[model samples]
Target: MRYHTVIAWAAAAGLLAGAAGRGYLAPLLPPDEGHGAWYASRAAGISAYLFLWLSLAGGLLMSSAWFDGLVNRARLLAAHQAFAIAGLALGLVHALVLIPDGWTDFGPADLFIPFASYYERADAALGTIALYLFAIVTFSFWFRGAIGPATWRWVHRASFVAYLAALWHGIRIGTDTGALPVAVLYLLTSSLLIGALTVRLVYVRPRRQAPARPPSRAAAEPAG
Candidate 1:
């Protein structure tokens, strides 16, 4: 547990440093005709999406019984949690980087509040909603006990909704999608998510049948 906590803190620090360096420090150097900011935002956004995909895939793998022998369920769950938190951090950088980029008039409201920005309002709103949903889903882990098993499960399902919203947002608003490599990346991630969901839904184990009750005393006496 201590080790995991340390890892979490380290990951958080790294994310903050990376975001700050990319957003503030890099911009201090000579400008590259605004390409610096553009490229940084694009790269961060793409990385965010990749992290989110990994997190989703990890969760799916952990939930399914398919990996029974190959990996321990507990370890898989730990990694799932790590990936989810890291993905959320990367996502914050992805949106925050845009503020310093100056390419878009994305003020604080635009980034945090859904549909606040006029630029690609619908798509941006999707991303914004996704961000909040992801945060909620991640935090739900700490409150899982209080929330109860059923409610925790219901809240976790929001991750899928968040993932879909993010995917749509990236497809519509992402500039890198035009490139062959990035496009292929998007396709592969989407395919994996869909395939995992299909497997989970189709291959889930049926509930065990309850044992039959024995005959009551009265019924047995009458027969006797």
Candidate 2:
């Protein structure tokens, strides 16, 4: 019932589900002519962004004192970890699903390697880089002890960079961004993240240095 144990279980369950969906459910689902893969990729990408946003928000809340009494940090951390893992999985699905789309002509290299795809190359590269950063941040949770707390913290901070890359990628390359609802969702979530981060930074207090001890009487007298 420990947090790490819960994270491990959740990861395993996600892998199993992904495998089953790919191996069994995919063939059973009704195809949408030639655009099915494109649709699936879009949905998965959006879902991944939403989950990543949630993970970032939860982390901010966990660190800030504003929610001290109202929320439980332990549960918040568990949820944060879970969301991060889910986002990574969904991001992978988002990339992999594109391979089947004849329109995009995405191969493994195009999806995995930054700038390898000619279709909106810069934006696609941002998404690929974001995925790698996200994966590093998520997996760092398991290696906190090995890497040390300070190192882990710095690694987690990279999520902000990853988030920006994702946001840029979505805005530039996502077909759904033209829709009012999708645009609004992106705007609102990004605003929330920025606001939370601002609050956290503003409220953080610097470590107070210990007051200097008064010079000892003996040392003062012997100074001559």
Candidate 3:
């Protein structure tokens, strides 16, 4: 089977599973009783962040020679792509599940459009923007051939911006950001990604120029 086909199926499966889970839990834990949608959104948001982190980390590893012998590049690339797709899927679920939450009053425009939400508009916008950026970067994989390698690389760099936006969004607006464990998770993951990127930048060797062919004996003897 083709790689793109697998990615499409995986994304579809993820969305279906998320929708089913939300449907099952929504009735049992009503908004008045426990705010199930809110909880689900938080969980999905955190999971998506973690998946994005993994995808970025894997991409850094793929570009750097540090893991060349230790890890299989092909597998690393596959994992990176898979994680990115999973992250995008979970991100959509994170936002979509919130539609049922009565507390926030998040309409489709508020959830999908940046700065459209009245509640914590700036912070929520960051998350919304991050989601869109993630989508662009993830889908760019499918169009890499058409866009050309240079453009594809530049598009992939948008992941860094997406990561930053997500981190900021979570820290500023996340309900559980105050918790020690969640704070620690955010700190640790961001630190690891920064470290990996540093290694990639510092250790990535430039292409070596071909050595100039030594001058022939005749040329050396009588240069003209």
Candidate 4:
């Protein structure tokens, strides 16, 4: 199957599954229950979105491999930004829907505040961090002429941190996963994607750019 097909299906299925799961739990979850349900809904929605955005990032990053056949690096970068921005819009929706829950204090500091969650506060912090990173990377989109490529590249590199943090945050809390196959999904798709991306960054991409190593001293010394 085409790469995009698998990505499309996974994202769609994750989204539908999360919505269905939350709806099924709604009647059981107290209408006045603490902010947890809001978080659950957001997590599910975001999970679906994460897959979608990552698929886009992956596709665009590797676009040279397929689709347009590596013709346009700048165009691929633009595609990535488009997908990421759409995902960010959905994420904002997730946050806005959850905001009225009256959970924690909402302030600029809380946006970066970490380890304060009595429930899943740390996890929330992680997600918030991811959101911020996304914002930074995409800032160049709006201010490309001003943001130079070097600074822009650094911001984009932080995306992996956001991805990992969000993934870790999602499955760790959220009561829905009690018997909801959360572990399986967490390990299989989320973790796998993270692992693959990390591996690609460390081992695959850098090997090409590494400067040529001079002949080993042992070799130059004539192997004794």
Best by TM-score: 3
For candidate 4, the TM-score is 0.56
With a 3 Å backbone cut-off (N, CA, C), the pairs that clash in candidate 4 are 64-70, 117-121
In terms of lDDT, the poorest run of 10 residues in model 4 is: 60-69
* Clash count, candidate 3: 0
lDDT of 4: 0.56
How many clashes in each candidate? 0, 0, 0, 2
TM-score of each: 0.78, 0.78, 0.79, 0.56
Better of 3 and 4 by TM-score: 3
Badly placed stretches (over 4 Å) of model 3 are 1-32, 205-224
Query: Each candidate: what lDDT?
Result: 0.77, 0.84, 0.84, 0.56
How does residue 61 of candidate 4 score in lDDT? 39
For model 2, the local distance difference test gives: 0.84
- Clash list (residue pairs), candidate 3: none
Error of 1 at 101 (Å): 2.6
- Residues 95-114 of candidate 1 have per-residue lDDT tens digits of 78777766667778888888
Give the CA lDDT, 0 to 100, for residue 192 in model 3.
Answer: 97
Off by over 4 Å in 4: 1-40, 47-60, 63-79, 102-118, 178-181, 191-224
Q: What value of lDDT does candidate 1 attain over all alpha carbons?
A: 0.77
**lDDT digits (tens) for residues 26-115 of candidate 4:** 565545557773765555454544544564356433632443444565455544555565566555555556544566555434444565
At residue 90, candidate 3 shows an lDDT of: 87
